[model samples]
Each structure stands twice: as C-alpha cells, then as structure tokens.
Target: MLLATLAGCSLWNSGSSKPLPADLGANVAVLGVRQAWTARIGNVGTLPLDVHVAGNVVTLASADGVVAAVDARTGGDLWRATLAEPLSAGVGSDGKSAAVVLRSNALVLLESGKERWRQPLAAQVFTPPLVAGGRVFVLSADRSVAAYDGATGRKLWNQQRPGEALVLRQAGVLLAVGDTLVVGFSGRMVGLNPDNGSVRWEAPLGSSRGTNDVERLVELVGRTSRVADSICARAFQAAVGCVNVARGSTTWTQPASGAEGVHGDGDAIFGSESNGAVVAWRRSDGSRLWTTDRLKHRKLTAPLLLGRSVVVGDDTGLVHLLSRADGSPLNRVTTDGSGIAAAPVVAADTLVVVTRNGGIYGFRPD
Candidate 1:
C-alpha cells in the first residue's frame, strides 16, 4: 500500500520508519495516503508531458495543441483552450500571470486555461516562457531572445546570436544570474540583458543538439542562484562563455563535465551530468561540494535541491533524494513508466510529479 504519513499526525509512516523533516509544520499532519483526485485530461503522448499548476488551477498542454486547466485538489476541469500548432515546453507563470509559447512562436497568456493575450515572436520558440523582471522572456529559433511587458503583448527587444542549424532545437535554459539572463545555445553560453535584450556576455559550452535551450543549460554546469533568478530550463551545452556577472569578462569559462542541467545560487552550483553524478560546487572558486555517482548510468535527469536535499531523477523512472551535504541517498521513489519527464515540484510534504503520460501523482513521505 502507498504510505502517506505516519500514524495520524506525523509526516512519516510509523511502520515504515522513515525520518521526517524537522520543518514539517503542524499544518500537514497527513495520516494515510489517499487519492486526492486524478483526472485524465489528455491522452498520453510519446514523449512525457508536464502539468503546470498555479494556485489551485493546473494547466496541461498536449502534443496536439490541446490545453486544459484543472483543479489541483479536486481534479475538476476549469477550462480548455485549443491551439493550431504544437507547443514548445516554455510555459510558466509569474504568480499573477501564466504564459505559453505556441508552435509558431506566439505567446499566449492563460488564466484558468482561457486565452488572455497573444504576442508574436520572431520565430518558433523552444524554451518555456519565463515571467521575470516585469517581463516575459521567450527564446526563438532564429538565435533570438526577447522580452515583453508581462501584462501587455508588446515586444520589448530582441537580440540575435550565432547558433547551430534549426533542424533540432537549441539546448540550455535561461539562467538569471543576478541581473543577467543566462542560457546555453549552439555550443555556447549566452548571457543577455533581460531588461533590453542586449548581449552582456557570451561563452562556448559543448555539445547541445535541440530546440530546447533550457535543457542545454541543464547539460552544462549549474549555478544554484543563477537559475532561481528566473524559472529553470532543461539540458544542452556550455559551449560559449558568459560575461561573469561579477567579473565583467568573457574569459571565465565554466570548465565542467557534460553540459546537462546545471544552475547556480551565485554561491553554490547544482546539477548532474551524463556521467552519472549529481554534483555541487562553490561559485566563487569552482570548488566541488559533493558528487554522488549513485545512479551511474548512460543518461540522467537534472538534479535539483529541495531544502537541503539533492534530488535527481534517472532514466530508469526512479527519483533519488540525497543529502545535499554529502550526496547520500535519503529517500527514493519510482514512477510507473519512465522516471520523470519534467522536474518534480514540491507542495508541502507532498512531492508532485507530472509524468510523460500526463499522470500527475503526489507522493507523501513514508
């Protein structure tokens, strides 16, 4: 049976004997695991899709351009919006507003899945739209990135970059290092001015093949703070150099392994590589904090930090939770199919997972 919580009031299952995080407040005194609700909004796609939630409403975008918003707690439908073209992964929110990128590089804002506004980009976008710094940043296929007023669908500025061929999406996600918008593309690291779309700095990261720039960034080294500046993106490369946010030079290269999903916190670096290690390093000196080769496999998912826990999902459809301090496994959970498509989101004691099959499941600590 799926264990939800300990006894009737604790965050752990007493019989299973799992340790409870000290921060669990008295609010979520989960008893046993119960199905809050599950709604099959769309048919499973070949590639795992994700479920994006805001407040109580969750939005699901299908491969066929079907979008639906569902109640997070009740699994009830709020609204649905259909699209003509397939959508890229760059759909996100800025708390008050949620933005989506259509296949044709048009950004549409959704509130409970109802269309609010639409803005056209230079070309098709590969990354998710990020609402940050009072603007929504969308990266286009023609090596362009621009921002628009979060409320209005007006273009702010767009800058072009040297890029790879367009057959595949670019790798890397946009990383906001302090004030710089950082991303990996066309075998390089690009840091742009999110305010005006100016090229602040550039770098060459290695081996990124795709339209998904966020994933290219994941393939590169990760900075804990630089990533949180905006939302996170997927993997690709660390091909080029970025103007160090503090150094103002393009010479400082992030010499690291596989340009997977790596972000930083300005102080600590976090992410994993295909080499099968979830690693962290010091931002100032590039000193290693910890590296766990627990799941040494051909491929691995991006690693993220949950509180002090280092969480990594592997291709085998299992997510391993480790202590960020030592890279030791703390807890582990397995999904029915492929490990996890999108990175997992946490809601209190529950670990929210959106699988490739469009199944959103919540796992409580045992």
Candidate 2:
C-alpha cells in the first residue's frame, strides 16, 4: 500500500526536508541479499508515487503520464499505455482493471491497453483510487467521497464532508476491506458501504490536541494494515492504534509522532517515526518492544516487516534491513540515485522498490 503525505511538522510543508545523507550501519553482514533485476519505468515527478501490486503483476504510473504492468519476478513489461496529461496519483488496479487520476482531475480507467472509461472529479485527487466489486471509489481533495460504475464510468453516489482549512498535498488512501469501504479522513476513520456512500460506522483514531487548527491536525496515517481481527491505523502527532474492525471499537491507542503509519505481523506492530526511529510493539498489548534511532532524521519511509527482517527505504535511495527482534541494522543496498519515495513492496519472498527518478529494483534475501 502507498501513502500520500507522511506530513511534515505542519501540513503545508509536506515533509519536504532534505534527507540526510545515507549512513551504512556497522559492517557485520547478517543477511545475504541479492538484486534480482532492475528496470526503468519512468520518472515519478516531484510527488510521492506508488506501484500497485496485485498477485504477481506490479503496475506503475509516471509523472510523464506513462503506465505499465510488469511481471513482478522478471521485471518485464506485460502491457503499457501513455496519457496526454501527467498523472497526479499513483496507479491503482486489481489485475483485471487499472485506474489513475490525471492532473486535470480526470480519473482514467484502462483494460488490456485500451481506454475503458474516464470520470471527471470536482477536486484534485492525490491518493490512489480504489477499485473493487466493479466500482471505483475516490476521496477527492474537496472532502467528497464518490463511487463510480466501473463498467460504464457512471457516477454512482457521492458523499460530501467538510475538510480542514488546509490539508496535506500528499493525500491519504481509500481501502475496500471485505463488505466495508474504509476511508481515512482528517482525524477519523469511517467505514462506508461500498455499494452506496452511506456511512456504516465511524471511529476516532485521534483527536485534536493542539490549541489551534494547524497544530491541532490529527490526520489518519491513511496507509493502514489489517492483522486478523485488528484494523490498525496511525495518525500524525496523535496516536498509533488499532480497532476491532468487526465491532468498530478501539483495541489500543499509543501516543505517537509518526505520520507514515504502522505495519503488523501476527505478533507485533512496526512503524517508522517522523523522527526516523524504527519502533516495534507487541500486537496484543501495545507494549513497546524495542526502538532504534540509528537512522534518525533520515526521512524514512514506513517499515516493511519481512519475516525476521524490517525493511525501510530512505530519501537517500538506500534500503535498510534491520533485525525484527531488536531493530538492529543487518544490511543495506543502494538503488538509483533519486532516492526511494515509496515504501518497499513485497510479493512472495521478493521485495520491490521504486526510485524517485524511475528505477525499480527487485531484491531477495537468502
């Protein structure tokens, strides 16, 4: 899953700080990693982009308006298409269909290299659109959630809500989990019916803690992960916590300063803080397990728990591998010089990462 804005100290800055130079941790090698292959998709422009993974197909869209699907293992293109306008959001697809939002607020859908349908939006879209159950869902910047008929590009229903005075340029995501459509708004998560825009349940993950609006921002981490009965989410300068998706109640809440959100294994939840500390906590009790600030202030992407290893990307184009048990750096690898902007994605045992400049790499640890 890709996230919009990790958010800076404030919403307007958009975490645009210069990433500190790469620091290769201690020289001991604990894991053997091999680069499987590399490919050039296209430049992703200045915005944070995401690569969509469905089954074994990895789909990508570029700021240059090019979209392609490649074999996740071979790094070979299966199909490719180009748009006349640059894309504003990452590519979203469920294998059978692909969708992208153009800079012009037009949501374009494609299938088998041919244009399927295009729907215009009233506001710009920053997050990856959601495609499920033959319906396309989008959360626009204007704080409106709408569903569109996937087959005919017809507008189904739209739910409008008031948003904050200022929101992050890096948008949040739209998730479809089972029968419920999960959406992260300014400070809460809402579960809505995928068929209609009706709200099924709403849960507050975090609340405004600051005295003023800017400082009071409590936005959902947006990039949420599910582990068994738990639906875990994090919020900026708010809390990292989970709720029982079935009951729509809070499971646990821990004060946190991370904006990128949390990832969970069966027993533990992992996150990379805004300050660059990779921390872990027990899944059941929300107890702090361990934390390592070795990569502090590096502008890290969210952490990916790969078995016993924790994988995270930095703004310096370096991927860091750390011990899941104690948060120790085990190994690191360098990619295209443009640095990594999106989280490293995994399909099976292979890890794929995209560079800001357009290089994609597949890595396997043995």
Which regions of candidate 1 fall more than 4 Å away from where they truly are? 1-60, 66-85, 119-122, 166-171, 175-180, 183-191, 203-255, 263-267
Each candidate: what lDDT?
Answer: 0.54, 0.79
Task: Residues 9-104, candidate 1: write the lDDT tens digits.
Answer: 111113554433223112322222333445554433432233455666665566556677655665666776776567764346654566777766
Candidate 2 regions off by >4 Å?
A: 1-23
User: In TM-score terms, which candidate is top?
Assistant: 2
Clashing pairs in 2: 5-170
Per-residue lDDT for 145 in model 2? 87
How large is the C-alpha RMSD of every model relative to the true structure?
11.4, 3.4
Tens digits of per-residue lDDT for model 2, 46-109: 5546667888888887787888888888888889898868888877788878888999889999
User: What local lDDT does model 1 show for residue 351?
Assistant: 57
**Residue 169 accuracy (lDDT) in model 1:** 38
